[model samples]
Target: MNETRQPAHHRGRGPGRLIALVLALFVMLGLSGGTAFAAPDDAEKPPRAVWVPDSAKDLVAAMQPSWNLGNTLDAIPDEGSWGNGQTTKATFEKVAADGFRSVRIPVTWSDHQSATAPYTIDATYMARVKQIVDWALDSGLYVVLNVHHDSWMWVEKITSDHDNVMARFNSTWSQISTTFRDAPRTLVFEGINEPSFANATEAQKFQYLRELQTSFHRLVRTSGGMNANRLLSLTTPAGAPEPAFMNDLYTTIAGLNDSQLVAQVHFYSWYPFSVNVAGGTLYDAVAQKHLDDTFANIRTTFVARGIPVYIGEYGLLDYPNHFHPSRVERGEALKYYEHLNHTARATGVTTALWDPFSYLNRETLQWRDQALFDWIKSSWTTRSGTASFDKVFVPKSAPVTAKSLTLNLNGTSFRGVWQGGTKLVAGRDYTVSGTRLAFTANALTRLVGNRAYGVNATLQARFNSGLPWNIDIVTNDAPVLSNATGTSTAFAVPTQYRGNNLATMHATYADGTNAGPTDWTPYQEFNKAFSPDYASGAITLTPDFLASLREGVTATLVFHFYSGQTVTYKVTKSGTAVTGTLA
Candidate 1:
């Protein structure tokens, strides 16, 4: 670990840094001066600051469903919403109607931040954001406020000593954190957007990220915000949650200062694999498997180690070019989304669909094409029927299980048990013959109409390790797991930055045994490569974004690795498998 390990004491912790330093001090002084790295005792589960229901559940239970927000609940809209602007409420309603518990509003803060470098959002603009917040809360949905596109701004300034960016970022949050200061525990505040540009090392980028996150906590606490225990969401270099991204997040903020934080990833892929663009054909199960495995691989790399992951943005293609489902697209996407939904549930990850208005093209707000609405519809069942007359929204007698989240099932007038049968257990069939039931946790879900929430027991486990041996460098060699003689070095992969599966860079001896570093052998990373996304002058492209398009025509790419191996292929039929590195 050439990375200098200086006394384990973080310098300049920003806001949360001081808290972390104090906690560290307590460990050094209180633990009999043992000098062992220490962490603060977990306080009694603090008040939750974010909980929300899906919009689908809301449609079934809205007081006034007349006003519809467009594809993005991000309209710099006017009244009837938050920013003095209109909203994408119709979209949010979809979230509420489903059995979701929260609404993640990805705001492009640049709209407000574009001004004199150090941005200041006016009352009119903020009112629009708050109005939407009110809508979600009023609908009993947990509201999550996060800066989305502005990650670009921070990146632009980070290198050139752009102090204004930092100032604006902090100042913006000061007011925001303070305004929602009295908000219920259901409201959440994420530090930044999908923070990164085309080129930024994972380590360096995350260092800045830590500074930003620590700032959020500092401002919130110092500002005496209401949602103090706010559930914070951390950013990866990009939306990819690869090992490098995860490690950076962990090292930078994990022990910095304690706050409710969740790791987040955006599930956007370009293969027969990514659900982002839904029209691709998955004719080859192997190709489909390869695609799906990508996400599974990512989830396991981070989540398996005990960090909760939230798939903040995932959706089948329902936009400009890919909106309409064809004979090919529908057949593929219909089952694809179902499988995606099932997979998400099985793993207990939370999901929020992108562009609610675009779920089924805006012209026809009703889901006119595709089977997303159907799949979601099947998973939910009405929980009640009575209006204000009933006084009680849902029956207190109803059962809520880890497998099933409460929802307004089907188009039923009243709420009823929507059997949590989406993901059948490994050996069990999701059948109803005599009443025995089976289910798996949905990767994606939300809470029902507004209700106070209790936090889930965090399923987390960290892997601390000892040093090992090193092995020979296999240049241009595709790792073959079948061999029992070569090394399977652990190269910590990069998340959204580029697509190399990151792992701990470890080396084993030629004898297929654990031969870690000892001066005899050294460790290294076998950097994977995909075709260049683009290049102009002295610049080169990386494999972070798999599918690249130019002039509306998507081209093929070959991924080359720093390890000297390269995989080449082209795009045919959304996800048709082409030849490349899988040699």
Candidate 2:
């Protein structure tokens, strides 16, 4: 992620000399414990003082579903330097048309500034940035402009060049705040992007980062214009979303007592799903837990405390990797985006997608992943149905074999159909009336045990609009023991099982008496009786399950996999040990 490069024009200088020169320049500019700037005359007052929203919640609410003009203006030295094309007025128009409420423009001013004292930002670069900002505002989109990826100055050890770094940071913001001082409330200023501290303890890093943010807050507030009331954003050290990092930031910045401030954090939860294509499952229990835990912490730690948080960057990148045969599955990507945005809205944390010309095709003004794009756009306007199976168990020999499924439509009525594979066989195997799906007894009996079965459907209301409304009614036939050993039982099924799969165990004695269909207590559940190896996509009975076995007893373990596929494995105990084979 490093893009550091010194200006070719500057000659070699010792580190000590450079530090002294930067410090001397800072003193000259009155930044070293002196008056930072001269008071502006009455004639220079801002034309109009925009009333910045006083509530952080309101500010975050207004910036929902934001986008980043990443790898563009934030590129070093010049726009388009990083392979991303130049920005245009039409790009902002498309972003608004695509349903983004706000835009974040990341600008790296280091390469565009004079390296010596009182580092001045280049006029041309400043004009270009202003142009983009104006375009977004004109298109009725909230805009956030921030210093980004200026690694040369802040990425080094703070102990070595703390003063020089401070000088550059203060001078840069003084210029930026002054330039946009008269801008409307729609324009927000972010202090920095992902500040890094080298060779420092967590405590030291927190203190230093807080000092930097303090400088930012002070500069923007006292820059002599409408900036005093403008909304300002500050990020924690490293821009991490961990609870500890957020708590530290909250503790440090709460001292400022500024209600107009918005807390910023970046989230890329579950790297295998978000970035690389390895070592993580999508939309599963584990992934959901991470999301829930992170957001819940932020909500309790910040949002509930009246501090609005914004996800400055979040979204999976479309990169090729060996684990996934292709780019992220469209359905999985849609689920990811929908869940994240939905949770954010519920938690009062605004979200912005980080795009580098992957999902959104900027050149053609179309989304490369249209399904993902549509899901995001429609979620803000549409109502959908939730489907679940009441009973996933399918007994191969019993006449009482029907799966009762229900779909609640939130009181909206719609025409529906049941589909399986490539055929539309609603009346053949199942019937869908209103929100109820009733599978035929014969169809349920024919379901292959130890395998996955799915009933797919779609619903379209007369008044509804947007992406196709569909659901997958999936359940497993009772798991049959696929293999057995002296002390172990194994069942094979699809790997997409939910947490509720293994909740019971039953035993049928050789004397025609039933021992139990024991309810696996949540605290001591059968799911906990086995260990899963995701890489192998299988679960093996643990010694805990083995300990429960008794000679001359046949046991059945019931569980469910993805789409409600239930499995029932039969095991025979011999000599105080259990052995099993597919039934």
Candidate 3:
């Protein structure tokens, strides 16, 4: 998901420096392979398709449970520059076998095209894109291809640089339409991804989008072959799901008078819950209501009007960083995914996960967490019961006691909790009363043998239907923090977690106003501002967070843990140096 402008913290040069270093190495080693493809005389007009095309609604419905090939062709300079590996035919095979019916391949053409009048896309890059699309098509998966990051990179300049933008846009699509003129109808053409405009009023933004989309429709229709009837998708400004954007997009498609057009929108849930900031640490009523209302509006605005809607991208904003602590709690995230899939089905919109090698391991072609993936996949067909929290945190220094958690049930009847193969005795080991599940002290003591500082045991809460909910038995203590000294660019608080997991961090000035990069909320974004490294026995304050601190002003930091413990500390940034002390 490319934003019009990245946040200051996200705009750091770490990735750019790495890309340059890697590209230089590739050149020095003479490993930059050939990109040229031998084109046949009739390459622009290949064999015609015999299969009849389905209506836009039917085609969109058939694309349920889709996936996105993100951060590949869309990667700024080249493929594999971002975390994900190069695209492979086996990747598509894996996607198909894993039950994804469609794939959205986002392509950024800026770096691969010329800056002159013709603005010809590099022949080699074009061929590579075609190869990947053909591979996905061979796997029997519907393909949605679009101009991706270029939307913000240069397309957004349409308002400021109209003629050049329009010329380049037309040339880019003309070449693309000609390249895939005879491709299968399964290969969809999306005009642009998350369209945006700079220095434009509401009227101008709407007018610009209508012009771009209409021009796209005209170019594709006149390009001949399957292009004449191919399914096309158009997104609102920034691909937001708000009503104004959706209404404008509807107006654009209706003006085109094309039944093969689908409305596209991207959803990352409510802002705070998406990134786990501003005290939105749970999937509460506000978050759930937002999902319900958004999907309901999409259905009413588009689907009911005979235009199918495609939730082009849907996932939490700060989801599943494989190398860092998850911003959102695992159980809470599970509930969000489960509810989202069910709601998507209820509203008749096809949804696609924005996977940039986070959900699936590109190197291993295996799910990073099979159990979590099971809940997501299962949610496509049925509901899953979840709990208020996944972990039962027990203080290692205190005597074991009864602990209770509220069960969501989610329309399922809760059966008893089980430890591996054996089912615990209901009344003695645990008790369930009207959505409340409590574990006896004896059961907890047995589970947390030796009071290990981490997860000691895992139990499954079974339900009459859907996947079982997992409960982790954890033994923990209030984390210990020590004073440290370092520069603002590099600083980590020495911490002894003992067992508890970090939840959120609160920052404030002496006058009680919020501090850090996001001053609007005292609760800074997890991973963005601070991250917990349990193995390293410390919590690292990100350079972005440290730099955002007000100079010569002491900011009090209150670290909150999942065990309901808060550790207070103070930090003062002076020049390039920073000092930390226990408060």
Instruction: Find the candidate with the highest TM-score and give its number.
Output: 3
**Scored by CA lDDT, what does every candidate get?**
0.42, 0.63, 0.86
Ranking by TM-score: 3, 2, 1
Task: Give the alpha carbon lDDT tens digit for every residue of 102-199 in model 3.
Answer: 89999999999998889999999999999998877755567899999999999999988999999999999999999999887778899999988998
Q: Any residue pairs clashing in model 3, and if so which?
A: none
- State the local distance difference test value for candidate 3: 0.86
User: Which one wins by lDDT: 1 or 2?
Assistant: 2
**What is the overall TM-score of model 3 with all chains considered together?**
0.89
Largest lDDT belongs to which candidate? 3
TM-score of each: 0.50, 0.62, 0.89
Better of 1 and 2 by TM-score: 2
Lowest lDDT block of 10, candidate 2 = 1-10
Supply candidate 1's per-residue lDDT for 472. 13
Task: Give the backbone clash total of model 1.
Answer: 95
Off by over 4 Å in 1: 1-85, 88-94, 153-155, 257-259, 270-280, 286-305, 317-328, 360-365, 377-583
For candidate 2, report its TM-score.
0.62
